[model samples]
Target: MPHPQAKIHRMFELVEPIATVTFSEVVNEAFLSLGMRNYWDGYFAGRAAPLGLAPAEVVHAVFYNFADGEVARHIPWVWGKVTPQEALAVRERASAVALRQQIGEVAESPGLVRVADLATRAAMSAPTEGRALYAGLKALDVPEDPVAKLWHAATLLREYRGDGHNAALVAHGIGGTEAHVLMALALGMQAETFGRIHHLPKAQLAAVVDGLRERGLVDAAGEFTDAGRETKQRIEALTDELAAPAYDVLIADELDELIAGLEPIAASISND
Candidate 1:
């Protein structure tokens, strides 16, 4: 049999994009209506909304991978213009609308209800200590509608896993810029692409890449060395292991049912 964490990881991967629906055009327009025309403004504000006017430093600390000033550029200021509660409302509503549009009839089917129940069980059972963002999201009320409930559950699970992943990176001694560079290499993208995503300057990005090469993590061409690949795998496996505890509430049959319900919906949304 696969490792015990394997199915839990599979379920998490399958439903991940349910939260990505928050980034769809529908959600963008909703943010526009609230005067958050910039995507980053919406992103930081919306995700951080459940935390209730958190400072930039707090967001930066919890988010753990943004370039130094990137979170500051959007937070505090975004809260000044739009309250966290308002942003939360817009995010939940727009995300539901976007997910509904993408997933169609499946959004209302009984199968989705089953997925929501099982996923919510896992989310609610997840550990809260040291997981700031997950704790914030967990504080919210579970939606009554099946589609919204599933989306909320998926988001909770995503943030839970994200919090664990951050801990894994920290434990592995990977800094934010270094982490982005490593992910860029792993994803087969230019290091600059990740730097751009995190808003790191070219010089800073180059420095990180050079440092990685010096550490024998990446070769001169900015690709992973054997040690780098093994390190990445170790970090990911640890992340998966940390995240697995949340799903412990589900019995074997329920896990099977949950995964079955999620797979088709996830496939539909992905292909859409």
Candidate 2:
């Protein structure tokens, strides 16, 4: 049997959009309500607001995947546009609005309440050590609205896993750009797609690819070699292992129910 952590990790994959979807109309309008014009500004400020105006370099480290200058370009300046408390409130409201629209009346269903409870239990159970973003989010009170509560629960769990993933990457000696390259190659995404997202210049990107080649993680064809696949799998396994503690509060049946109950809800938003 797969490890229980692996099952929870797969469930996370299906439900992740609940926390990560940034392009929907409701989310956009909500960010605009904060008087934020640029998407990145809202993104950085809203996500990092939980850290209470952390320095740009600190945000860059905790975020752990953007290019060097990318995070620094936004951080403290974004705070000037919106206070951390205001940003946090807007984010919660925006998430609630979007979830309610997508989920409709089912947002308050008893079944959803139970799922939210299970997820919140797990989120609350997770330790704050080395999980800065998760720790920050957990410091706030959960929303009183059921739908917002669910969204908050999922967001907390997402950041919890994210912090663990970053730890695994750092432990493996992977730089942010290199990690992106490995993930793109492992998942069959275009390397340039990640390059554009991270603002990496072609020469720098080529150097990263070359370094991976030297390490036998990629071949001349730029596909994952056997070693590359194993390395990716190992990192993922470690991430799941680290994330497992959150779900430890759930019994086997409860874990199963959590995943099942979340499927339709996640499907609702994913198909929207």
Candidate 3:
């Protein structure tokens, strides 16, 4: 088998996107139920179950994901009607539809049968806090397809990790744009990706960059300053620490097996 660290990295490369993309269908459908077209409508509505929280409370649960100003701008609008329970129910129902569609689209291929067992194995080995957090989430009443079950579990665990990361960001005094800016500098990610992912106004994003620069976390060119780098590492470390609970279930071989199995499927998904 591959070395443990290599396996872990590959597992992330393979599993992360699947966890992210498949779940988008559920979140997307939930927003569509509200008859909205804007990205924010989908984003907010989908995550209104942020950590399985109510809409009034979800903002706090997802504090680090949206800037104080950005969240403030949109959350009040969202909370006027939707509750956390409502959003959660929407996500649960939408997820079953999404799973059937995705599975049917791929099941004809040989990869579907193979990937599901491996993916489920990986998810089963994730942190217990993350796994246990799933207790509160609405389950997708999927058909007797193992692949669908794995996909649903992986998606829920990803959401759990995200909620934990958001909590870390909040505790560290970082908010939406600032967290993105810091991550961009530390990870060498494009600043533009942040705007696209979060739907931040250009001016608002720039303003946050300016604020981070003032705090000595980033330089004039939007690179990490020495202090910024240190802070970034700490934040990342903390996030991993928070996320580690889920990964702790696996031994090295189990992780390697999961990664190796998923790599081909990840490739297949990417090609299509």
Candidate 4:
């Protein structure tokens, strides 16, 4: 059997888009599932003011902020005292701590030895994929304009699938939902795909597609227009530019060996 911690990591990886924004909620869910809710509540309460949040809002954000509205609803908790920027910073720091601790626990859990092993293998494989992606981007030609740069970066990031949300956030200044839309389109995914992969609803998916079209990022048939294609090419170029240095830093054989070691661990965790 996979360790419960492995299951927790899989859940975290799936919901990483919201991690910085909805840190408290993700941590609460993970800890609560492990029967550590009360312990966290007390710990957070003591750290709230220092973390720049009211205790209640911190707690609420951590567990209850599932969508946009939920986050908006809690705005009053720190209306005068905390700026939105500050709040995000607090959430990010707290979330990082929570995730690190969770991973540590998983690493220590005897039941998760197989899962941990798989995770090690996955990490090893990441470099090769990264290298291939970098090469693909370098092979593409994109203009040097700033607007073109933004578009290119967004498109290349979308190709990674794993990094698509980050690309979406950069391109649209909207988080998760918008990221999901861009990723889905880039991958030729449909409403059902979004539903299964990210648990998004049809209405939400429709809205995102519509928004992209309105912004001239995508077209009526959910295809990338000339502009969209240009944007994607630019993104790929940017990715290659950025990754080249890192690729040079690591030996290929080392990367492959690392991937071989980590693949099983990542697989075990996902399976769990």
Residue 124 of model 3 has an lDDT of: 53
Candidate 1: 10-residue stretch with minimal lDDT: 193-202
Q: Summarize candidate 3's per-residue lDDT along 1-272 as a digit string, tens digits.
A: 32344344445566665555534655576666676455565566555454443443445444445555554455556545566567655655565455545445554456555556555544455444433344343343432455555556556556556666666777777776677777676567756575433466778778888888888877888888898888777765566556554555656665556666666555655554
Query: Per-residue lDDT tens digits of candidate 1, residues 75-127?
Result: 88887779998998889999999999989998778877888899899889988
The numbered model that scores best in TM-score is 1
What global local distance difference test value does model 4 have? Answer: 0.40
Sort by lDDT, best first. 1, 2, 3, 4
Where model 2 places Cα greater than 4 Å from the true spot, the runs are 1-3, 195-199
Worst lDDT window (10 residues) for model 3?
A: 130-139
**Residue 84 miss distance in model 1 (angstroms):** 0.8
My TM-score estimates for the predictions, one after another, are 0.96, 0.94, 0.70, 0.38
Worst lDDT 10-window in candidate 4: 146-155
lDDT of each: 0.86, 0.84, 0.58, 0.40
Question: Over the full model, what C-alpha lDDT does candidate 3 score relative to the true structure?
Answer: 0.58
Better of 1 and 3 by lDDT: 1
lDDT of 4 by residue, 1-272 (tens): 22233332332333232222223455445334433334333233222323244444443433221344433334343334445344333434445444334444443444334322332232222243433332343344432332222223322332333333234345534445554555565677753465423555668667776887787878888777676656655654443333232223235554344334334333443343
| Clash count, one per candidate | 0, 0, 4, 23
Q: Best by lDDT, which number? A: 1
Runs in model 4 deviating more than 4 A are 1-30, 33-70, 73-176, 191-193, 196-208, 223-253
Candidate 1 colliding pairs: none
